[model samples]
Target: MTPEFAYFLKVNVAFVLLYAFYRLFFYRDTFFKLRRTTLLAFFGVALLYPLMNIQDWIREQEPMVEVIQMYSAILPETTITPDNVPETDWHGLLLSGVSYLYWGGVLALLLRFLVQLSSILLLARKSKVMQIYDTRVHVLDRPAGPFSFFRLIFLHPGSHSDKEIDEILTHEGTHVSQWHSIDVIICELICIVCWVNPFVWLLKREVRHNLEYLADDTVLESGYDSRSYQYHLLGLSHTNKSATSLSNSFNMLHLKNRISMMNKKRSHGIGRAKYLIFIPIVGGLLIFSNIDAVARITDELVESSFAEALMPEAIQLPIQLFPAVNKEEPAEMHRGYVLSKEELAAIKRAEEQVFTVVEKMPEYPGGQKALLKYLASSVKYPESAMRNGVEGRVSCSFIVRKNGSITDAEVIRGVDPALNAEALRIINAMPEWSPGEQRGKAVNVKYTVPVSFRLANKHKASVSGTPAKGIDTSGRIFTVVERMPEFPGGQYSLLRYLSQKIKYPVIAQENGIQGRVSCSFVIGADGALSDVKVIRGVDPSLDAEAVRVIKSMPKWKPGVQNNMAVAVKYTVPVTFRLQ
Candidate 1:
């Protein structure tokens, strides 16, 4: 996944879990003030938790350890076979649709928020203002609000009796003093971003309700009759069904829950201990957020594994920290794994040596995406190879010097001579890179890339001036078919054909180079063999002979897919046995 998508998922998951914990522990408690603080803290933690890198802090390391970089993925031995419709295209299309839908919802909701906010601002200008002490009250001519927004409260003073006005002002004053509008706005903004997540809506509701609890609790504390205030709120609920979206609405639609909390006995201080749950939850999130740390290991282990993959005894860059011969000082000196002082001195080269890996890998003019785009837009298919329908990936390796100059460009693995030279040309022509760093010092680094050449759906019209007939040019080569293509005369006759047509090279025979050659090819819908290339070669002559024989075969029955002829891929092994 891309970093942006992964971050979106992490943040939403955290929000859902935190909201769940709130409902489970503190939802029913009468600790109105503490509940308000806890909900706000939940929002803070949810937004910031995913960004903390815990591994950087808690990772234990050996003292004086050498931090060599080992990248096994640098030179992969895989072919890149581009299809007519790459799977990535479908994935990108799906992702685009989802992105459009998400942003559309956000924009629509944002427009709604702006409209609601504008309506309030417009009323603040038109309504008659009444300054009661430190508060500014906007008296609307219509039956609207009885809601508090920061220091501004909106309500129609003419709609209520003198006594009711006093109770409404007292309730709204608590909302203003406690800055409850800030909580409402916070929840609304979070809900807008994470509207797809159902749990956030519940969390939003909880936040708004808690603010009401605070306002109601304050009115009861300020010498108001509890029974009369409760009746007044219920009456307001029936008359006013709607209010401002971004403000603290005083509608009593949630009167049942609010009244229950008001009548319930006050929660004891012991209830605060439930908040200890934050420790483990936050700790769990930290463990999850730094999940990439689990893949990290000391380079020493990776180097050992890499050596074993090649000839283990043939090459070894041994590094170990051995203490001086002081008392109680042990050193890391394993048998056969340690190097002598003289051998170490001899192996240690100059600082100018090119590194296979470094503290930071060199970056292309742009990042990986731009690098791919540059290669795609700049690369040209060799006309000779294209005419012959030759296609495969060319794996190349090059060094970026300390001064960011490209050098030592060579194709390590090649499909065809023409394609190999073309791949090298592109690498040599690349612009300078950002030099890699090792120990805060600029250093040369080696980079590798596999450039794929494919003729999956290419028409011969561009190359040979004739359209490719009997060709699909619409889909990928089928690996599985209802009817598999076979050699014209079965396996026995096919072996006889190769034995009679093949000529073992005198030089290879003299050199005793005899082994199996693994080759791949595609049998087109017209039963013509194409896209022939060697997967593994025993010798250059043997590889050529194998491909030549395969390409010269007579037409076989083409593979059938969905009752239609389709191109089928096949892999065959040709062994040269010296008898």
Candidate 2:
């Protein structure tokens, strides 16, 4: 898996665990009330987010064949070739967006509910009154008696002046009125789900402190003397135990901060300034929690698995970033026919024929230069020619005629069309290759040939100009030249047929046109024209005329590669010149 994806998964698991721990121990009071609600929200977001993004994600992973089919419907038949479509990169952005929207809504709802619950608790506490004695406090315990609604004091009874009582009452009442318990509960639950994240723990602590601070500030607003209130708070420092969700009369640990805050004079309007800090902190948390970032991590992991599956045995089982490419037969290979020697030979012969034809053609400008140079030059190459440059061996099968000529050729283990067509064309144009003789007699033999299109030094040339100008010409130019194959009948007959079929200007310029019109065509196993595409147009009229004429031609003897009739790619240049 990709590192990003691994990180995402790890973070998610950690968050959930840490959150669970916090909910169980740290914030059990709030957890009991909202645990189910939080869990339901998380599950709903998870399932719905994935569903919303799956279709788009699938489209991102679509294979090349499917993309070709999609474009084929929109483009002209001749232009519906594989070269027209490109590999698409899936960034996982859409998935992330959907996930963010889902989770954001969940978080918002949870927060809103917590706020409402706090408001309700505060209202209930405000409606009651408590009588204070020297050592104990009493409330008119209702039928719901000693419940969270009634203030239950756990402090030792003590006498207090009017001012001290006012301070104590104001401070404790603030906690009840603001429903600080609810905030503590909500944060604790968040910590449970995000337990693995240290940040969640920090956030939970901050939430608790904020609740205390908010209550302390409210009490100090009641006009009690700061020094006297501080003494009252110190006197009430004895610890107390209260059940979850119950409003306790005393919290000894919080007394110091409560008294200190009351003693400090308020800076004019500091509350507004302090409140502004929430904007960036809360906004950052929301942004980080978005689903897009999570899914990107997942996609990286899946892509890494795909890459590892393609590794060779020479390397370690888990391949690294730069893995060597070698083909090992998968389980399906055992069911197929193991190719024979004769079959392999025929395929090789066909490929040789196609290569020979391409070599004989006029060299492109800066012929031995880089592919980009050849491609960028005024002279255009055909898509079929580009197929011929595909690196690797292709095995095909074909039949030999009584006159020792190759007939039907079919590609069994197919190569890319650009290279495959070149192999087929050469086989078709063979000058009576010796037919296979079985049992010491001339007999029809099935054969296969594996043609490898390796780049040799002789093919390289400078793209910009001569190598003297700092242009590198050390690589062969793999050009896709467009050309019309020499059909059985003369050019004149082909021209006449084209004029009758297509409604376009049909003219054959002189035999030696100043520039060449390179066109690419596919030669099927039956020697019929299948797809004829023009990669780069010469004169618009010339290109149209050339395409029309090339498409309107008779079939030739099929090419034989490996004793099988196979489709071949052929590139020929139609030079229009003043004779």
TM-scores for all predictions: 0.52, 0.32
Residue 363 of candidate 2: its Cα lDDT? 22
The runs of at least 3 residues in candidate 2 whose Cα sits more than 4 Å from the true structure, single-residue gaps closed, are 1-165, 194-203, 239-241, 245-252, 265-579
Q: Model 1: clashing residue pairs?
A: none
TM-score top scorer: 1
Task: Report residue 532 deviation for candidate 1 (angstroms).
Answer: 39
Candidates in order have lDDT scores of: 0.66, 0.40
Steric clashes per prediction:
0, 74
* Residue lDDT tens for model 2, 149-191: 2333322224445665556556556656656556556555555
Question: Residue 242: error of model 2 in Å?
Answer: 3.6
Name the regions of candidate 1 deviating beyond 4 angstroms: 61-88, 131-135, 292-579
TM-score of 1: 0.52
